[model samples]
Target: MVGSSVEGLTFDENCQVLSVTAPAGASGLPVMVWFHGGAYVTGSGESTKYDASLLALEGVVVVSVSYRLGIFGYLRDNLGLLDQLVALRWVRDNIAAFGGDPSNVTAFGQSAGADSVYALMLVSDEPLFHRAILQSAPLGARGPERAEMTAALREFVSVDASTSVDDVLAVQKDALSMASARFSPSGGMPFGPVLGEIDLAPAASRIELLVGHTADDASPYVPDQPEAWEIATELVFAGPARQLAADWTTAGGQAATFDFRWRPANAPLGACHCMELPFLFDPAGWSHAGMLAGQEPDPVLAKTVRSLWTGFARNGMAALPSRSLELGE
Candidate 1:
């Protein structure tokens, strides 16, 4: 898909693994690095769900990352976060080759990816990127206890510090789904960054942030339990995001909040989780709009969101949603 969208494509073999999409003749464009969401057990930077072609063409360099996941990412240590931090360092050092400004970069993610953004922001002592756009971050995830992971691991293999990566992957590939389901009550995700290990440097710092949630973001996750859905969405995604905005603002940082309430026509998923993606990536594109039929997203509305996202990376300020959402104080 990316083959036809840009003038070039490149992958790195260093501490990071990212795909760079460079627009034709684009140079010094602001960079937008994307992180994909998959419950933290599944997903890669290469998922079609996160295509950055249109966004890149609109005047920014796009970098989509593939970070560690599942047990490989968060089991006993924050190895997954280590990979993500390395990716950021790579962008800070190498995005210029793709016409991206090393100093002007924005990191964006949704769901588990959004959770990653939150963790990353909290851990960085200095600016790895100038801005962040978090979508539906599950801040309510409980820290996985090492004993629990060890017990889970023993259910698959006996360990003596002699276990190999192959043994670990073999067990995780088969057991993660079960483990995540078992630990669902602790954290919303199958695996997440552990507490005491996800501390951000200096405890407080201002970062230009654009955070939001779909009005009905939790429907897809808990369609049957309406009451549970509403409460979880607020406590885990919406409420925490609002508090983060308020905290950032209180710390003298700038933040713009949004409520994606655009309902899709003829779709059971109202303005559900990830529903805003079709609009942000490409409202008119067939991949995401196949079901929109007569309910195609407004071109003006799509443009407005695209502009706000890129604008945040470019200028440290995100414009309000077309329906007029306000930036929090």
Candidate 2:
């Protein structure tokens, strides 16, 4: 619970509200709202790992938001996404009270959270935020067909369409496990935004984007199976991100892309999934890098990563020094 004290000040009773971290004596600064990752099955904006206080201290009002998860979040027309939208609305309407500039907002997220950021890019109406950082979004994961999605929910959860709302939540843990096994057609986890076309409503809120994936983000899951790993990575993270970059740039938008190739010494992992997290959060005062190779975070790498992200938020572009961004100019 790194920023537990700061988070407790803003979260709502249901824990669905946004947790904010503001620098002391700040005024009219940029805002950076964050989303957490958990495959849409689990995760909370309240999670300590997401505490962006260090980033907040850089003079921006850093906000980490909580949303509905798993069956509760995705089954009902993607309630979790709606939850995020509501949070964004809240930020748009009230962040100024917290000393944040509503018009200069940067919404960023990782993994499932990153999926939400990417989806938000397509939001056509008066957008809540102006810029976005989509880190490791699995755009290739299509939404399940209505029939396929609900059948598993109905059978495994032991509830029919008319089942009492109370009964839907009574599903057992074992049932969840069973559903996961069947739901994931791809090698990775199955849960994300539903697939559908949303013609954007014209507006001034075209989202400026910065996107990337860790070099070996998907290796752990399918190491032994080369073909599986390649397919999963392409369909889940890498390929779609690149395509989105191309599409956005083609549409005359500034969309910067990168490949996080920082290799940690503790484990054999090579810039694997979630490895870029510590740097983003600037886990200051935290000496150990946890599972990221059991080594102290390299001060050089940590400083560069933070500078890059914060710089992006401040400039609405990937404007960082050469050392700050690995894929340098």
CA lDDT scores, all candidates in order: 0.69, 0.69
Worst 10 residues of 1 by lDDT: 1-10
- Per-residue lDDT of candidate 2, residues 178-205 (tens digit): 6557655331444455646654333213
Per-residue lDDT tens digits of candidate 1, residues 172-279? Answer: 666755665666544346566655554332333555788888776776667777667677677667887787777777766777777777765665655667767766
Model 2 misplaced stretches (Cα beyond 4 Å):
1-13, 143-147, 150-180, 183-187, 198-205, 223-231, 282-290, 318-329
Residue 115, model 1: Cα distance from true site in angstroms:
0.8
lDDT of model 2 at position 82: 79
